[model samples]
Target: MSIKYKFHDPGAIYFVSFAVVGWIDVFTRSVYSDILLESLTYCRKEKGLNLHAWVIMSNHVHLIVSSREGYLLSDIMRDLKKYSSFRIVKEIRESTIESRKEWMLYLFAKAGQQNSNNKNFQFWRQDNHPIELDPHLNMFEERIDYLHNNPVKAGWVTNASDYLYSSAIDYEGGKGLIEIDLLV
Candidate 1:
């Protein structure tokens, strides 16, 4: 995995994306999305993640993140993916109000079967697609814009800051759901 998604610079900010298996709309429900948010909060508080920007879409999440306090970015990514996958899959399985439970489980199960790494269900895809953001090239700002505008482009909201599941609100000078380290 390190060969594919290399985090060479320990202190450099990276724009990373990880998607659900089959691009399933798993986050249409607030429960699953909230689980992810909670896990992110845990990671930030306990795992030394320096989160600069983030957006959670229906099928994937975009993050501009780094590591601090001697933490490796790759290790943080691994733990985040592992924990979130387990919690989200468990929530989906146990949710009584989830109308598409059976179908969703089938899809996840099929994805797991295709991947030898997963035991039963594969919630998140293996690739994080981490792109190291170079401040000299202004790639950080560009990716932040793209990340915030994802909800707007998907027609979920007319304005990026109007979306609740993103750090756009933080960028706009309002407190967002998840506390983030502001990008200066």
Candidate 2:
């Protein structure tokens, strides 16, 4: 666990990507995706997270985010990941409609077994791979476009704004599922 990609500059906006333990399609169901959305909402309202862009794919999520003044970006990310991982895994286990419950649990459990930090299951991977966004270099705009277009690139939707689980709608001047501070 190197500190190479860890959030160091609290004021710097970062583009981060975090995936499920085995790249499982855990977010195929709205139940799981909704949980993630709720977590993001909580992070924004209660955790001082300044979200500029975001997209929730089937097995992972991408975000361009920063912390408000007096808050640490790393702390916000740690809490968001920790809380969402626990809640999402719990939801999967308790979901009566989840057809792949056993399989998903097995995979998560196996991943947890390999990772010493987890008690029983590991939902998200340990690393966020945060890349600091440089607005002067136009990396900010580039990353935001990439984040919004993720679902479109994956063939989930023809237009990025049509993707319901992304902030593309916000960028398009439409209300999105979660409240976001638009970058573009």
Candidate 3:
């Protein structure tokens, strides 16, 4: 029932990043990313969320998003995080695809049990440091470029659009994994 931080200003553009707990590479596989996509899709359709840009890296997510009808961005992010954590954990624990990763997950799970009141592993970092996009402060373009070039910067792919989990392609030519609301 606590009010989210982004609720204070409904019309502000926010660039937010949420890292995985322990920065584990939970999203190196598409399982967790798929869950994130599903949750985002639901939020966008049901709650009138405006997604400006997004990038799902190995252990973190960068999003340039706003909302419609006074919807709170923080609440939407919280829902996405919660749902992805649940679905990904369940998937990881049962799937043979992630079975060989037992030790890493066990450690993550133990950390979660210790950190949270729940009995399962946690997925995302608790702190969501959303920087308000202010063109005056000169951070807006920096964040946008960072999100677009992250995969390329990481050497995962030569072109930003080559990363299948990012919105760079959507910006370039609409060949992205998901629909994007072009900011410009």
Tens-place lDDT digits, model 2, residues 106-162: 999998888877779988888667999888999988998899889989999999999
lDDT, candidate 2, at 129: 78
Off by over 4 Å in 1: 1-4
CA lDDT of every candidate:
0.90, 0.88, 0.79
Ranked by lDDT, the better of candidates 1 and 2 is: 1
TM-score, per-candidate, Cα-based? 0.95, 0.96, 0.88
Give candidate 2 regions above 4 Å deviation.
1-5
Off by over 4 Å in 3: 1-7, 136-138
Query: On residues 64-164, what C-alpha lDDT tens digit does candidate 1 reach at each position?
Result: 99999699988888899889999998988998988889998999999888887777988888876689998999897899999999999999999999999
Q: Model 3 compared with the native: what TM-score? A: 0.88
Q: Clashing pairs in model 2?
A: none
Each model's Cα RMSD = 1.5, 1.4, 2.6
For candidate 3, give the lDDT of residue 143: 81
Kindly list the per-residue Cα lDDT of model 3 for residues 1-184, writing each as its tens digit: 1223454577888898888777888788887788888888888898677888899999899998888876777777777777877877778777886754687677668767777445667667776667788768767667878999999999999988888999888877766777767776
| Ranking of all candidate structures by their TM-score, best first | 2, 1, 3
